[model samples]
Structures are given as C-alpha cells and as structure tokens.
Target: MESKTTFIIKLVTFYCLCTLNLFNAIDIYHNDSLDDFLQDHAKKSIPKDPKAGKLYDVSLPSNFTGMEVSVVQLQSSSVWAQGANLSYFRVPPRIYPNPNVTWLDLVFSNLGNWSSYYYNMPNYTFVTPILGISAYGVRHAKGQNGQFTSTTTKLDLPLIRHPIMVRFPSVWLPRGKCVKFYSNGRTTITNMSLSHTCEVWGQGYFAIVARVPSTHHVWKLWVIGFGVGCVGFLLCGFVLFKIIRFVEKRKIQKMETESEKSEVLDTKYVGHSKMPCAFGIRTQPVLETDYFP
Candidate 1:
C-alpha cells in the first residue's frame, strides 16, 4: 500500500512537470519597448507620404534574422480607403532566382479583410534579402484627398486595416503602435509613431510583421493534451484507490465472521464434555451384583 501511494505521487509529479515543459515551450514575445527599439533602429529616409506611389529603401536590424515579414495596415472608416494596397520587395531585384524571392503584395478590399498575411522570403536557411530593398504603399483613387488627407496635394492617404487576433506562431502588435519600417535605407528596422499625425497621411502608418517561432503551435497543443491526460490520470487513481479499499474491507469482515463461528463451536464442545449424565443415575454397586451370581 505504501509503495502504491508513492508510485501515484511520482506519477502525478511527472505529469505536472510535463505540463510545465509544454507551457515553457510556447513562448510569447511581447516587448513593451518594441516601439523604442523600432524608433532607434528605423530608417529616417523612408517616405511617409501615402500617395507618393514611390518605393522607399529600408534596412532591417541585425537581430532580425526572420525570413518572412508581414505588412499590417490600420483600419479606417473611410469607404475610399477600402481598396488600399501595400507591397514589399527584396534588394537587388532579379527574375531567375524568383523561388528565392521575399516579395509580398497585399490588397485590402473591405473592412473585414484579415489584418495581416505572411509573405515568403528568399531562402529559409540563409537570412538574406536578395529580391529588392524597398516597400511601397499606394492609396486607392477613392481614398485620395479623403478624410485622412491634411494637405492640398490631392494625396491618397494610406488606410489602416482592422487588427486581428491570431493563433500561436503569430505576433501581436502593441496598442496604437502599428508601423515597422527600415531605418536610413539600411538593414535596421523600426516602427511608426503612435500619434496619427506623424506620417504624411495623418490617417495610417506602415509596419513590418515579425514571425512567430515555428514550435509555438506544437507546444500549445502538447500543453493542452498533457493537461487533460493529467486530469484523467488523477481521476483514475482516486477510483482505483476507492475500489481497493472496499475490497479489503470486505475481506476483513469475512475473516472476522468465520473466526466468531469457530469460537462458538469450540465452546459448545467443551460444555458438553464437562456436563454430568442426564438425570444423575450413575452408581458403583455393579461389583455386588456379580458376587451373588
């Protein structure tokens, strides 16, 4: 019984450890200072004008070794800005190694469109941007000179897309901090200002999306499965313990009953052996009767 209890305790401990490991494997990267990091690393030369319709060169930070980058747009209420489009390209554009291209062209058609999408980068093994070194945002004709515009240049303001809640392997943007661009047309990347008026359009800003670790989803599933398994294991242990205890109690009761019956039979036999003959008729005169004969 003691050994069984110890075994159950160990099993529960192991289950708890497995659950902890699973949770640990699922990492969430939420840097409150991400905005500061972007500001310090962002390029100052990228055009902030939404209607420029011109590509701006950007360089990413050395720490950003991710292959794929997402362009997230903030959502706006204006109807004209619904058809806005954003595009990205790798440096040194070429057509032959296209499979190794890290280019993306995302279009926003409605307010319900997904806020973000993952784009394929050059090679997965190496962290190189071989396609083009610039990104561009073009405001749709309907949105030009609309609610987001502040100047008389007839500029088409870039519109913000609705933010989305994604599953594991996807990063979430901080509140009011949506833009991520390159710094000084170099590899260092940064984020846009939270205030709306910082950019030329005064309505929306552009940002680079970060990739979620590949193992994130796997760990999430493992944690859930392990938690369920642990619960089941504990329940089974409790039921088995109850069953064993009930069986042992029954066996003990049967043994006590049999012992009581044996004792009663022994008492009856001893009492009968000690009792005198019934009616007390036994005598010693048998010797006289034989002499007369």
Candidate 2:
C-alpha cells in the first residue's frame, strides 16, 4: 500500500510539472512576446537616476504606436508605507512584492489598437482597450566588460492587502462590467466600482465587456425577410387576380362564339337590336295533316 501511494504521488507531481511547462509555453503566442517587447524598451528608457519617482515613457516601433507603455520605480519601503499610486493604478497601503524586493519596477501597458488582436472575449465585446500591470525586480548587474547594466526581472506579487484599482479612459456606450482575463485561461466579470474603474486582487490583462446582444441582428434580419416575403405574396396575389379575370372573360367569349355557331336562325340587326329570324316557310306551308278535301 505504501509503495502504491508513493507511485501515485510521483505520477501526480510529474503531471503537474508537465502542465505548468505547457502553460508557460502557451505565452509564446502573445503574452511572452509582449513581455519581451516591454522589457526591451524599458532597458533603453530607464533614466540613469530616478526622475522624482515619475514614470518614463517606453518607445516602441512605429507599428506599435499609440499603445501606451511606461514604467516607474518605487522603493518597496515606500510602497509598504503610503502604497504605490501611479498613473491609472492604485496599490493599497502595505502590499509588498512577493519574494520581497528593495525596489519594484512597475510596468504599465495599454494595448490600444492591438488589444483585440492579442486577446479576445468571446460572446462579449470590448468597449475599451486592454490595460495591464506587471511588477519586475530592479537589477543592476556588473557586465564582463566591467560596466554596470540595468535590467528588470519579472517578480511574483502573489498576495494583496486590499483590492487594486484600475481606471480606464472614458468610453461612450452602454455601461459594461470589468472583465479580468487570467494567464491560465480563466475569466471573471466584476461589477464596475465606478463608471470606468475596476477592483482586482491579482495581476493580469483586463478590460470592460458588454454582453453581445446577438439577437438584435437576428431580429433585424427576420424583419427584413418577413417584409420581402409579404411584398412578394402581394404581387403574386395581384397577378393571380388578373389571370382569373382574363380567364373569366375568355370563357364568356367562347360561350358567345359557340352559341353563334350552333344557331339555326339568321341574326339580323333591326334598328338598334339584333333580331333572330328563321328562313322562309320550308316546302310551302305544309300543314300537320294535308287537308286536300
């Protein structure tokens, strides 16, 4: 029994590891690629000295223009004290990065036009672009050539003291709920805390979603088809009515011709009326019985 239990445990562990590795590989499609792009730009954009704890914009390729990318550095101590309230994001007080860090590199992304291309919410439509927040460990490593290099390594912020807030830009449409999309393919819809704000516990991509009222288009198409059918039905009825009238007139004309052909009398026009007259007496005036006496 002990041996069997140990074997089962080993099998479960191996399966879990395989699942995790496969999950990580799933990011090659977009998530991982976007991460690399953000980090690459950050390396070039981070100032040699902190700019008053202000955010610095990360430049992207021309094709990726209009998508927002910015980074801010905050000391973990300060974050634990007053909380890190940067642009569009609010981390409540006393929530430090997991695995602990001296300084946290906060990277913010707003995939404007590229939002739908990178992510999708089926059966729902996105009214706003996808917004994301990621935390990375600040690093300055000595290179082989003796030059210090700046880099950011992704860190896990597994715990939160309170709900984090994300504010999206204004959108004009039906109000929608906040949709949170996890890396592991889980999704949740949270009610809007404000008109355009959402509260979340962990980090991942998020956007506002409205229900896809598919029946609206379906009903529109049905109404159009019904109207067309009604018009066709009316045209068909009109043509049938004309045909019936023509057939009735032809029947009357045929009866009149038959009567003319079968008549044994001569029809003469007497004044304004037609008079049917018989021929002159046949075989003289033959009586029913000859009265020669």
Candidate 3:
C-alpha cells in the first residue's frame, strides 16, 4: 500500500512539472518558405477559365503604382460558401485590408441568372445590385445544387503614406475554416471540420491572393524578446544559487575557525603551570629543592 501511494504521488508530481515546462515553451512557425511561395504566386498570371473554383491570383494593379489589390473567386459548394447565401454574398466582409489604408473599393458581377431575369423569369432570378465599392458577385446556374459559376471580385486598396504598424486582415468562414494574411507576404490557411448545419451545398472553393507589405521585423523582435527573457531568467536563477552556496560555505568556515580557536585555548591552558592535564595531573613548578643541591 505504501509503495502504491508513493507511485501515485510521483506520477502527480511528474505531471505538474510537465505542465509547467509546456507553459514556458513558445511555438514559432518559420515563414521563410511561405514568403517565397507567395512571392512566386504573385508573379504568376491569372489563368483563363480555370475549371475549379479556387482559381485566383493577387498582384499589383497595372495602372496604380503605389497601391495593392487582390482578385478572388469563390466557387459554389466550397467551404467558404457553406454558410454564405444571397444576404451574405451581397456585402462580403473586407477580409484583407489593413487599418492604415486610406480607402478601399470592391467590385463584383454575377454572370449567371442575369440573362434569365431579363428573359422574363424574374421570380427565379437572384436580385443583386452594386452596393458601393464593396459589392460581391454570385453566380448560380438553373436547377443546380451548388453555384455553377465563380464570382470574380476585385479589391482596390491605398495604403497610408507614412510608416506605421498595420494589422493585416484574416479570413473567417464557417466550419472552422480560416486564413491568416501576414504583412510579410505570408498566408496561412487552417481548415477543420466543425459540426454545424451548412447553408450552401456543392463543391466550391475560395482563393485570396495579395502582396501586402512585409512585417518581418515585428515577428523577429517578438521572438528575440522571448529568447532574451528566457536567458535572463536562467541567469538570475544561477546567480541566486551561487549566492546561497557562498553563504553556506562562509558559515561552515566560520564554525571550523571557532572550533580551532577553542582547541588552541584549551591546549595553552592545559600546559600552564596552574592548569591540570587530561589525566588530572596538575602542572606546577617545584622550587629548587635540597635534593637538587
């Protein structure tokens, strides 16, 4: 029974130690490869009539020398469209603009269902109008379970003239689908299965490609700070340990010195003429006696 209890205590202590260490560790992702990949992606031209829905490209505007833009196409039945409908599509959120940017414009067109409404099937057609620069296009074929066409959209952005910290936009979708766009031209997309009712049905996909300003220095500084903090903490602990050891050594030395002094005093007194030795023999001087004469 005692051994069992000791084992349980050891297990609990080990678990606690592991939890502490895990909390102290930091996770960092190397974005060098991602930077190179997005850079290459920006150079590639948009392909014509890509069969799949995730076909899109990001690049600088041909006429605008100082601004950046992103061209995206969201296909029907894809992960991003599962929770998207006419209402959601009309005013799609701006997912990639930094706060420092002065202005933004979004333009979209619905290639499908426009002709049907013009040809007298008004009830069957989806009503869509340009809602300022933030309009989004939706294309749906007749009798199709998913949107059969892609909604091509363009985003116009102008950055602030001065140097400032910018918060890059991230894409959020239903079912735990999210994409993070970094200022350093790095993009990370995370997709996880979430339990929820999907509003849109079909195999569709969305692609957002942009070349935002790089913020590599910010991340580098953060990592460096974390590393410096760890080193500082370890150094402090080491110094404290040394101080404690020095204090203990001084105490031991002082005790030994006091003991040596006590022994010396005892020896000196024992050898004195008036003091008695360990055997109880007294050390006394005898006067010159008559026997000596």
Give all candidates' CA lDDT scores.
Answer: 0.35, 0.81, 0.35
- Residue-level lDDT tens digits of model 3 in 1-293: 57988999999999999887655331111322322232333324444543333324356323223222233344322412231222112222223342222222222222122212112221121122111112123333444665466432322222223111111123232233223323344434443333221111111112222223246866888889999999999999999999999999999999999987766433236454555334444777777775753
**Least accurate 10 contiguous residues by lDDT in model 1:** 89-98
Clashes of each: 23, 0, 4
| Cα lDDT over the full model 1 | 0.35
Best by TM-score: 2
Candidate 2, 1-293: lDDT as tens digits: 57988999999999999888777545543664676667678757888787646999988766566789998888888878788788788878777787677988888899888788678888888988899888888677899999998666788765456888888886765368899877666889988868778888877778888878688888999999999999999999999999999999999999999987887897789999999888777677657876777
Q: Give stretches of model 3 more than 4 Å off.
A: 1-176, 179-201, 205-214, 217-219, 230-234, 237-241, 244-254, 257-281
- Give candidate 3's total backbone clashes: 4
Q: What is the lDDT of residue 281 in candidate 3?
A: 42
Alpha-carbon runs more than 4 Å astray in model 2: 1-31, 140-151, 216-293
My TM-score estimates for the predictions, one after another, are: 0.22, 0.61, 0.22
